[model samples]
Target chain A: MKTPTIRDVAQRAKVSLKTVSRVINNEPSVRANTRERVQRAIETLGYLPDLSARSLRSATSYALGVVYDNPNAYYVISVQNGVLSACREQGFGLQIHPCDSSSPRLAEELRDLVRRSRLAGLVVAPPMSERMELVRYLAANKIPFVRILSAAEDPADGYPCVYVDDRDAAYEITEHLIQLGHQRIGFLWGGVSHRSSPERFKGYESALKDYGIPLDKKLVIPGDYSFDDGFRGARRLFALRDRPTAIFGSNDEIAAGVLAAAKSCGIDVPYELSIAGFEDSPFSKQSWPALTTAKQNTEEIARHAALRLIAELRPPGDAIAAAYAKNEGFSPQLVIRDSTARARLPAAD
Target chain B: MKTPTIRDVAQRAKVSLKTVSRVINNEPSVRANTRERVQRAIETLGYLPDLSARSLRSATSYALGVVYDNPNAYYVISVQNGVLSACREQGFGLQIHPCDSSSPRLAEELRDLVRRSRLAGLVVAPPMSERMELVRYLAANKIPFVRILSAAEDPADGYPCVYVDDRDAAYEITEHLIQLGHQRIGFLWGGVSHRSSPERFKGYESALKDYGIPLDKKLVIPGDYSFDDGFRGARRLFALRDRPTAIFGSNDEIAAGVLAAAKSCGIDVPYELSIAGFEDSPFSKQSWPALTTAKQNTEEIARHAALRLIAELRPPGDAIAAAYAKNEGFSPQLVIRDSTARARLPAAD
Candidate 1:
C-alpha cells in the first residue's frame, strides 16, 4: 500500500499544500477551525509527517523532553501527566528522562539527551529546575525550555518559568495555626537544596511576626523532605523542655510522619497538638486525621510549563506572545482538614 | 557542525563499520564488551541514527509504544519506568499512549498510533492486556507486542506475554490468614473485567477448601480495586450480624480504605478485626497499620516484558532465542505486616 502524503491531507481537507504544511508545522497563522479540519484529515489518512524531511526544513524535532529528579513518585507522575497532556494536544511526543541532579555528569548527560533525541525543547521539573548552572547551560546553548520552579518572584532576565508561591502558601498555613490560638508553633524544614524549603520557612517566620509571637529558635527543626525526617523531627520537638502545641511540617509526607510519631508517643492528635503540612499530596489525604495542607497544583504548573516551552519553540507570532503572557505564577491554597485544630493546655499537669 | 555517521562511531570505537551497525541494530552476534564499547562511542560522538534511513532498510522504527488505561498511577509509572529503562538500553524512544480499552474506536486509535508514531512494537499493560479481541487485532496486523498480564497460565498460542501468577499469590496470602486462626474472613474484590480479580478469588476459595472451611457468601463483597470500594465493602461486612473476624482486600488501596473505615467505626486494627490487602503497593506501607499483603514485583515483571519485546523485535538469531527462553513467570511473595493478626472472639458477648 502506498503511504499517504502531505498532498493527500491537503486534498482531503480542501486546502492547499502550503496550508497543510503550516498546520503540520504548528504555525499560529492557521485558523482554529481550519487547523481542526486539517488534523481530522491527517487522522483519517493516517498521515505521519516525515521527521527527516521536517528536520531538513527546520532544526526542531517533534519531540519534547521532560527532565526530572524527584524521590516523590506522586509528584513525578503528576508532572508527567501534565506535560503529556500538553504534548498530545499539540501532536507532539514526550521523552521522559529521569536523571540524578547531583550526578557529576548531569550537564553532559542533558546535552547528550538533546543532541541524540533531537528534542524541540524541554520542560524542566524541580529540583533540577532550581539548578542555576543547568539553567545557564541550557540558556547559553539557546535551547528552548521552560522551568517549573518554587520562587517568590520571576527572574529579572526573563527566562520562561512557571513559579509556585511556596512562601505565601506556607505563611497562610502558619497563619491558620496562629489563628487557632497556638503561640508556640514548631516548624520542620525540608532539604536545604530545595528553594521551596527556605521560601516556606520565610513564610512561617513572617506569620509568627504578624501574629506578634516571638520566633522560637528551639521550635525550629532541620530535616529533609522524607517521612523519616518528619518522624525524627517530631520526636526531637517532643523531647524539648517546652513542647510545642502545634507542629508544621514542610510537606504532607513530613506531616504524615508527625502523625505516626505522635501515635507512637501515645499522644492524641488535634486535641493535644495540632499539626499542619504543606503540599496537599496523597500523604495528606491518606493520613488518619487527614492533614491540613496547602494545595499545590503541581500537574497544572507542569502542564503550563510544557505549553509555554512549545510556544517558545514556535516561530515568533501572536500565539507565541499569548503563550508567553500566560506563564503566570501560582499560589497554593490552604486546605483545612482534621489534623489541625485549636491548641490545648500542657499535659504535664 | 556536521552530523556524525555510523562510520565515525566505528572509527571512535576502533571496530569495523559492520560491528557498529550490528550493535546499533541490537543484533545478538555482538559480544557484550564490544556492544558496550560501541555504545560508549555512540554516546561520546553524540551519534543519532537517521530513523528515515533505518526505516528504509528495515520495516522497524526506533520507537516503542506503551498503551495503558490503568487508574492506579503507581502501577502505570512503574511500568513506564521499566519500559523506559529497556528502551534507553537499546537506544529506542518510548511513546506512551493512555487509552480507554472500552472505547468503540480502540482498534482504530491503536492502528493510527502505530502508523503515525512509526512504532516498532508495543508494551501492552492490563486490563487492556486481558482483552483477547485487542490481542487478536494486533496479531492479525502482525504488530510486534508484549503483554503484561496477571493470569494462572500462559496462552497456548504463544504470543509473547509476561504472566503474573495472581492465583498462587492470592492463595499464599489466604493461607497466611488461615494460619492466623481467622476462619471467618471477609473478601473484597476488584473489578470484574480484570482477570486478576477472579484469579485472586479462586485462590481465596481454594484456600478455604484446603482448610475445610465452608465459603460464606455473606462475607464475600463485590468491589472495584479502589479505596472507596474497600471502605464501602468493609462497611457492608460490619453491618452483617455475623461479621467476619478478618477482611481481605483485593489490593493495597482497598486495604487502606478498610483501615480508614475500621478507624472511623472505633474498631482497632489486627486486634478487633484483622485486615489483609493484596499487592504491596505504596498504599499498604503508607496506611496506619501498614497492610499485610502480597508483594507483586510489577516493576521487574514489566522490565522483563520490555526485554522480551525488544528481543522479539531483533532479527532471528541465537540471542533472540535466548531472550525468548528467558520468558519466565512470576509469583508474588506474601508479606506480613501489622494489619493482620489472630482472630478474636465475638464482641456480641
Candidate 2:
C-alpha cells in the first residue's frame, strides 16, 4: 500500500488540496469546522505532512524543544508529558534536550540544538529557566521560549514565563504545621541552584515570624532535595538534645526520606513527630505515611509554558498575545495528608 | 552569525566534502580516527546537518521515534535517556510517541506518526513490542524498528530485537527465597498483557518444582504490575487461613505495595513474613524494607536496542549485522536486600 499524501487527505475530507494545506499550516483563514474535518481525515488515512519536504520551501519549523537539567525523574517526566500534550494538540513535534545548566557551553549547545533541529520554540524548565545567562542568550538570539520558574511576580525579563509561587505554597504548608502547634518545626532545603529552594525557605520563615515564634537556627538543617539528604538531615536533627517535633522537607523525595529516618529511630509519624513535603510527587503517596505536600501540578505548569511558547510563535496576533499574558502565573495548593498531625505536648514528646 | 554548514565542518576538519558526507551518513568507508575528527569539527563549529535540507535530496530521515505505553515513569524516563544518548551521539533528533498499546487505532496512529515526522526508525519498548500485528505492519511497510522485549530466546521474527531473560532472573529470585527455607511462598503476577509476566511465573514454577514444592493455586494471585495490585494481592494472600510465609511480587512497584500492606497489617517484614520483588527500580530502594529484586538494567537494554536500530539503519554491511546479532541477548542478576529473610519457625506462626 502506498503512504497517504496531502492530496489523499484532501480527497477523503472532500476539500481542495489547497484547503488541506492551509489547515496543515494552521492558517487563520481555515474555518474551525473544516479544519477538524481535515484533521480527522488525516488521522483516518494516516497522512503525514512531510515536514522535511515542506521546510525546503519555508523556514518555519514544526518542532518544539524542551530544555532542562533536573535530576528528579518524576518532575522531568511530568513536565515532558505536559509539553508533549500541547505539542501533539498543535501538530508540533517535541525535541527533549537534557543538558547541564552549569556547563560553560550550554548557550552554544542550545544554539546548536535549535539551529540543527530548526525548533519552532523552546519550553525551558528549572533550574535552567532560572539561569540568567541562558535566559539572556535565548532572548538575545531571538529564540522563542517560555520559562517555567519560581517567582512571586513575573520578572518581565523580556520573554514570556510561567511563574510558580513556591514561596506562597511553602508558607501555607508551614502555616498548617504551626497551626497544629508545632513550634520547633525543622526545615530541610533543596539545592541552592533551584530558585524554588530560597522561595520555599522564605515562606517557612515568614510563617514562623507571623506566629511570633523566634527562628531557631539549631532546628534548621540545610540539604539538597534528595532522599539521602533528607535522611542525613533528619538524623542530624534527631541527634540534637531537643529534637524538632515536626519537619518540613523541600520536596516529596526529601520528605519520604524523613519518614524513613523517623521509622528507623522508632518515631511514630504524626504522633511523636510530624513531617511534610513540597511538590506532591509520586514519592509522597508511596511513602509509608503519605506525605502532607503542596500540590504544585507541575504537569499543568509545563503545559501552560508550552502553550505560551506556541502562542508566541504564532503569527503576530493580539488575541494570542493577550491569552499568553493572562496565563503567566500558577500557585500550588497545600494538601494535608497522613504524614502530619497535631503536635503532642512537650512532656509527651 | 550564519548557521554553520557541512562545508564549514569539512574545512575545519581538513577533510573533503565527500569524506564529511560519508562520515555524517555513518558509511562504513570512513575510518574511526577520521570519524572522530569530523565529529569534533561538527561540534566545535556548531554545524547542524540541516536534516530537512539534506532529506530533500535523499530518503534518509534525521529523527528516530520511541513508541511505548508504559505507566512506570522511571522506566519511561530511563528508556528515553538511553535512546536519547544514542541519538545525540549520532546527531539524530528523538521523537517520543507515548501511545496506548490496546487502542484499535494504534497501528494507524503509529503509521501516521512515522510518516508525518519522517522518522528514520523506531525504538519500540514493550508491551507495544510484544504486539505481533504491529511488528508485522512495520515489517510489511519496510519501516525499520528495533524491539525491546522479554524472552528466554530470540523469537526469530527476522527483525532486529533486544531480548531480556526475565525467566532466569525470576527463577533466581524464587530460588533465593527457597534457599532461605521458605515453603509456603505466595506469588504475585504482573498484567497478562506483558510477556514478562508469564516468563517470570514459569521461572517461579520451575524453581518450586525443583524443590519438590507442589503448586498451590490458592497461593498465587493475579494482578497488573502496579503498587495497588501488589497491595491487593498481598491482602488476599494474607487472608488465606494458612497464609504463605513469604510473598514475591512481579515487579518492584508491586513489591513496594506488598511492603506497604505488610506495614499496615502490623506484620514485621522479614521476621513474621518475608517479601521479594523483581526489577530493582527506585521503589525497591525507597520502600521501608528495601526489596530484594532482580537487577534488570532497563536503561542498558534500551541503549542497546537504540544502537541496534541505528546499526540496522546504516548502509548494509556484515560487520554491523554481526554486531547486532551478537548484542541481542541480556540477562538480569538477582540483588538481595532487607526485604527477604529466613522464614520464621512454624511454631511462631
Candidate 1 chain B weakest ten by summed lDDT: B50-59
Best by DockQ: 2
Each candidate structure's TM-score, on Cα atoms with residue i matched to residue i, is 0.90, 0.92
Q: How accurately is candidate 2 docked according to DockQ? A: 0.64
Clashing pairs in 2: none
DockQ each candidate and list the results. 0.41, 0.64
Q: Write the per-residue lDDT of candidate 1 for residues A67-90, one digit (tens) a residue.
A: 998777788888988999988888
lDDT by residue (B1-349, candidate 1, tens digit) is 5668899999999999899999987889889999999999999888877664565456678888899988787888888888888888877888788888889788777876776667888999988888889898988877888988887777655788989999998898888989988888899999988889999999999999999999999999998998889889999999999878889899988887788789879888988889988888776776667789999988888878888888888767858547665556899999999889877655543
Best-fitting candidate, scored by lDDT = 2
True-contact fraction per candidate equals 0.24, 0.62
Listed for every candidate in order, the interface RMSD values in angstroms are: 2.7, 1.5
Q: Roughly what TM-score does model 2 have, to 2 decimal places? A: 0.92
Clash pairs for candidate 1: none
Q: lDDT per residue, candidate 2, B132-223, as tens digits? A: 99899888888889999999998886877999999999999999999999999999999999999999999999999999999999999999
Per-residue CA lDDT of model 2 for A62-84, tens digit only, reads: 88999999888889999999999
